[model samples]
Target chain A: MTVLDEIETCIPALRRYAHALLRDREGAEDLVQDCLERAVARRTLWRGDGPVRAWLFRILLNRFRDVRRSAEGRAQLVPLDATVEPARSGGQEAHLDLREVHAAMGRLPFDQRAALLLVALEGMSLAEAARVLDIPEGTLTSRLARARETLRRMTGRAPAQDLVERK
Target chain B: MSDNLPIDDEALIRLRHGEPADREKLADLLAADPSLRERLAEWDRQDAALATLYNPLADEPVPARHQDLLAAAARAPGWRFRWPERIAAAMAFLAIGTVAGWFAALHQMPGPAEADLATEAMRAYATYSVEVLHPVEVPASAASHLESWLSKRVGRPITPPDLSGNGFRLLGGRVLPDSQGTAALMLYENDLGQRLALYVAPAPAGVETAFRFAQSGAAQGFWWVDNRLGCALVGDLPHDALRKLSLSAYDQIDQT
Candidate 1:
């Protein structure tokens, strides 16, 4: 497949991750669009040695951080913890307490939330996630640990698990 | 249950995978430790919940804005401003202005407020003009949803501004959030495949509406803030070519 086509396949995942992080569908779409613009703009800077999805994820994250920092220009603080509705699904999936999960997520610091989302939601390997976040694998592990602990404490339920997560 | 072995991330991973060796060890060490198994089940359920929450976005249709961004990046030489082409554009603008009175305004630099609106309009143009597949969230066919959704989000009544008289067709719009409340980006396309975007955001309270225009390397735009909204019309067409189109859109919005 062509590069743009490959990028399209990753778009949904990018949107999901962005929405989960930003908790705004429109903002997440804009974030994903910006990420696509940068990837297609600077595709040359990205070495093919690594996964393109990872690179796109990296850019989306950096752009998100840039917006966050600029918005926090020491004036009116934009609340990053806006209440979010988790993915809306029907039927058998109705049992999931998405609101509870979303509320728990709102309380997490950005780093831990990001780490947890990458590992659990996106199923990234520890090494891959570490590379994406520009942190060491050990640090990524500790972040996950802290995130899980925090979620457990806040939710008063079995913490969100990273099922089938790889090392 | 026997050994009170502490569970680390590594141990949890093994248990999650149900590695036979770990299972056998668990069988021997803590024969009835249902707690570990129960924890694993929670993790599985949470993972499933997240998968359900986020996995569906991929199925949602791709927007025209994203497709255009991808195509434009692929078509461009680079993301940097093309200075030589821009100089050529200046020459062309003068040539066109001599023939059509409207091009003269294209040469003027944008004021601060107009500059902000123009840049957003340019962004809207870059995001929607080149799209083919899904260029709109609510297509023109479903004008009511498009209208109501945009109106609600933008905190103002919005009728899809008409441009058929100017040869551009409505392709619908999406609401974008801003510091104040929200902004509406409505897209239009002429027969030649040139797309235009009409972006509407509320002006800071107390700002009155006026007819204003601005231009940049990417696209030239005309913007005004009525007592209720700050409106901009953007497209890749030269300013002279877009004047009639912009005016037509303004007229429709004025009625609104």
Candidate 2:
């Protein structure tokens, strides 16, 4: 496929990943736009060794980091209430539960959230996610475990007995 | 079945590798553990919500403006030209100069070199102009220091040209290398959010030049080579405004 076609195919996934990271629709779309532009500009430099999706994710992550770092002092956390919309299905309780999950996601440290999203949301293999994150596979597993624990506690869910049994 | 949890790192590896037996063991362990079930459920919900949250963006049409920007970038003169092709083309053209008609043909062909330079200059301007943090190597606030530093690097006694009369305040200056050689780029901006870039590089010996104007996309550029230096002024301003800026910059730099 042409570079532009490959980029177009990846946009949906990129948007999904960015939205999870930022928790704001506009912010996520803007980050995707920037990532696409950078990738298009540097297409000649792209070596086809790694999966293009992984490379695109790496670029999106880097751009997000740069934006966050530069906005560090002035950054404001988006309130959970602001992120939820009126449910088209009229299931207010389910919507509220979703909002709680999102807020819990926001409370986790960035790395853990990134790991969970890559594994659970994006369905990337542990090895591919590790490569995208520039971390060892073992580290990824441990982070995923910690993230799962934090998320369960935040959501008021019981600790999984598998974890206790393993310990 | 207690060992089904894959607690040992090796068993965990087997499970990750999608070994069927290990997968069943892991699933059974999660099924037997309430806490594990809750945690897994939470992860599943989070994933579902995220998938739904960003689904709209996929169908939301890519902006026509952004597509136009990409198209223009693709059509840019130097986009497909590798360094070797550029050098070879330059050499071939120069060699063809031995034939009278070929030399004239070479002179008549628009090289697009100036347009490429202008594009680079405007891109650099746009990138640095909007930055609230770390705008330039030297801020225009310290005009003297910026001038001296850039001048030392470019091997010219440079000064930030006074553009107060033209409503543009000197923003700052930086040194950038182009195909021609190392050049000095000075940035300027007005209150109206318009930015201008002036690039000066030493001219080859005895190459007398004339003022030339060219446009690329939204930007207009004016270029000339004086006895000592080749200079270009680039911006999105109208032709008259760009010409006026170029003249003002030339007058100031010449006096120095």
Candidate 3:
């Protein structure tokens, strides 16, 4: 596929990831736009061996970090409310009720959130996510575990204990 | 089963993925402790929920802001030259030599080499003007970011001249190293889509010139040196128009 086509295909995923990270629709869009422009401008930098999706996500992740860092340094941070999109908007399964899950996600450390998004929402393998995040796979595995455990604990709503009777 | 099963995520993920040994061992452990399977399945539900919440966003149309950015990127490079443009450039070169030679003589400036420096700036303008891709590294929409970026990169403070008053708005800028010092290339375009570039750099201790003009082929350039900064404004516009741009750029970029 052409670079533009590849980029277009990745846009939705990048937007989803960005929105999750920033929790502000406009801010997420702005961040993804910057990532797209930078990727296009630096297309030559990509060796073409890896999946374009992974590369784009990597760029998006790095841009988020840089912008977040500078914005934090400036102390002009706009507190991101997690209700930017109420999960029920899509008629998502009411059983899960994951808005609290998202709230817990927002409270996750950056690395843990990033690692979880790569492995969970994006369905990337541990190795692929480790490469994209520039972290060792062991670190990624640990972060994912921590993120999952924290979400479960904070939500206090996992159905695991009741699953035996339900089944 | 618990005696041999690893509790870490690595083993858990392996079991989920059906990696044989890990899955077999984890399955035996799961049979013994049904809660293990339930907990892993619960984690799956949570991840599934998160995905369902976010997947819908991808279906939304890309915003207008991003579409504009893509269009600008498509229009990024300014350096494609057609046969007609090349022919016109050849004709302009002759005209430039005459204008540049006479302009240099009129100045009767102390440094002969500085006149050549003006020609060098003109060359840089020529090199980048015909570019259809990757003209200036940064796009003009981020003018302040471009300014700070070029400034930090070139190790010189660069205040890109505002030419909107002269019917030109900045397209963007890039940095170059010249014999004198750090040189910056800032590109601008007028309403007619006509492009002009200002090449600015520090002048050597002895190299200095008043406003001078140069052309090679169709490109005409006007340049001057003040204190430490040497400035050149080049374009395919008329000699008078380019000259005015040079002087205007000088005023806007003057550090003092």
In candidate 1, position B58 carries an lDDT of 61
Superposed by TM-score, candidate 3 places the C-alpha of residue B24 at a distance from the truth, in angstroms, of 9.1
* Tens-place lDDT digits, model 1, residues A16-101: 89888777789899899889977665554333457888878988887777667566647443334344323323222323476767
Which candidate's DockQ is highest? 3
Q: For model 3, what TM-score is found for chain B?
A: 0.55
Model 3's i-RMS, to one decimal, reads: 9.2
Candidate numbers, best lDDT first, in rank order = 3, 1, 2
TM-score of each: 0.48, 0.49, 0.53
Q: Which stretch of 10 consecutive residues in model 1 chain A shows the poorest summed lDDT?
A: A158-167
- DockQ of every predicted complex: 0.15, 0.15, 0.23
Best-fitting candidate, scored by lDDT: 3
Instruction: Show model 3 residue runs off by greater than 4 Å.
Output: A76-94, A157-167, B14-33, B71-256
lDDT of 3 by residue, B102-191 (tens): 445544464755666677777788888778797888987666688898778656678787565457878899888777666889998876
Better TM-score candidate (2, 3): 3
Docking class of 2: incorrect
DockQ of 1: 0.15
Q: What TM-score does model 1 achieve against the real structure?
A: 0.48
Model 2 chain B: weakest 10-residue lDDT segment is: B79-88
Which CAPRI quality tier does the interface of model 1 achieve? incorrect
What candidate 3 keeps of the native contacts, as a fraction, is 0.37
What lDDT does candidate 2 reach at residue B240?
A: 74
The predicted structure with the larger TM-score, 1 or 3, is 3
Task: Summarize candidate 2's per-residue lDDT along B1-256 as a digit string, tens digits.
Answer: 3554436433343354334575687688777666445434555665666566546665677666456645765566662425234333433443454433443454332245544555566666566656666656787766657877888877778876656446687778778876666778888788687888787876555553444665767777877665567677888888877866676676556545
